[model samples]
Target chain A: DAGITQSPRHKVTETGTPVTLRCHQTENHRYMYWYRQDPGHGLRLIHYSYGVKDTDKGEVSDGYSVSRSKTEDFLLTLESATSSQTSVYFCAITQLLAGGRNEQFFGPGTRLTVL
Target chain B: DQQVKQNSPSLSVQEGRISILNCDYTNSMFDYFLWYKKYPAEGPTFLISISSIKDKNEDGRFTVFLNKSAKHLSLHIVPSQPGDSAVYFCAARIFGASGTYKYIFGTGTRLKVLA
Candidate 1:
């Protein structure tokens, strides 16, 4: 386990409502990522943070924004929730193994339903 | 365009059989590949991974095989068990802008191991 946790295990909200999801990591790893899982698209990257206050957009970052104020916390916000935005969001941290190869450890995930 | 693709959406295998899941990628620059197994309503867990320099990496019953020329990789689970049933995803690590490496994931293939 990478000591990753996501808030709001399940939620239901109306369209246009704003929502925020939090990811907390106890490992203090330098790299953190947010991804969404959809039935046909699989897991699509939404955003990532290389360090505190350093963030980058992922392929599917159109309606989402992210922030990292501390090494242990990363937050993802949906400015206006849409039906298309409903998904299971995952948080992950990268870990380097002895062979110099890296792998990501994921959180429990948050299921959001936009009505 | 999707750089990583898992053409098969589902597969079924008899218990104590071998289960193979395939993934294809378009980019040759991907330096690392990983496989993740996810159960319903839970986060994905790392199954196994292979570096670009190696053709195969095995961990117990899970083995990952990479073909650099074909940009293809596959996960082989030997002596499949009922507990091995889950949605499997393949991800490739690519160097993105700002010296950050991003993971591109396939749509996933659901494996159902029958008893």
Candidate 2:
């Protein structure tokens, strides 16, 4: 809770609808990540950005897209919602240090349900 | 295939006792590992981390041990409290060529401390 906030704590939408979830952070960290958590599966990274305008896909990037236009904001979008995409989404940030250690901070999370 | 795995879905421990949670990874390139705790409807909070350079790292009641040869790690919480009851996740990161990094997480282990 140190400065990260996720919008729309809970959402319900129909399949095939486009949905977007927003994650905002006040820490101004350099790295931001989007992840989804589901039963029997740990949190899987959906997308991540290293810097503004620099974004990349993660292990489960299908149907998901992310944009980081600024240091404090990272947006995750689903072009077409599906029941399988119903899960808890989390946003995380990390600051790289000269040393090898980097600690990540997470947001409260947004729960999405596709009907 | 899952790069990170947490076989135990849940663990129970008596208050003031020790609780151990295990995690395994299939990726050999991973050099950093971390543990996080999450409560109901909340995002994961950073707990502890260990690098391949060290086999163990401890902070107060929590200790993390890494076994690189076995690609395994475990978290030990001494004097487990009811407040410690939550889901724990293990994560790994591999640094990419361009100074970018990505995390892979295990499913998670729900820990219950019975008073």
User: Please, what's the RMSD in Å of model 2?
Assistant: 1.2
* Runs in model 2 lying further than 4 Å from the true structure: B96-99
lDDT of 2 at B47: 97
lDDT of each: 0.95, 0.93
Runs off by more than 4 Å, candidate 1 = none
How good is the docking of model 2, by CAPRI class? high
Q: Which lDDT tens digits does candidate 2 get at residues A22-62? A: 99999878899999998898899999999998998888999
Worst lDDT run of 10 residues, candidate 2 chain B, spans B93-102
User: Candidate 1, residues A1-115: lDDT per residue as tens digits?
Assistant: 7899999889999999999999999987999999999989999999999999999888899999999999999999999999999999999999977986888999999999999
True contacts kept of each: 0.90, 0.90
Clashing residue pairs, backbone N/CA/C < 3 A, model 2: A42-B107
Clashing pairs in 1: none
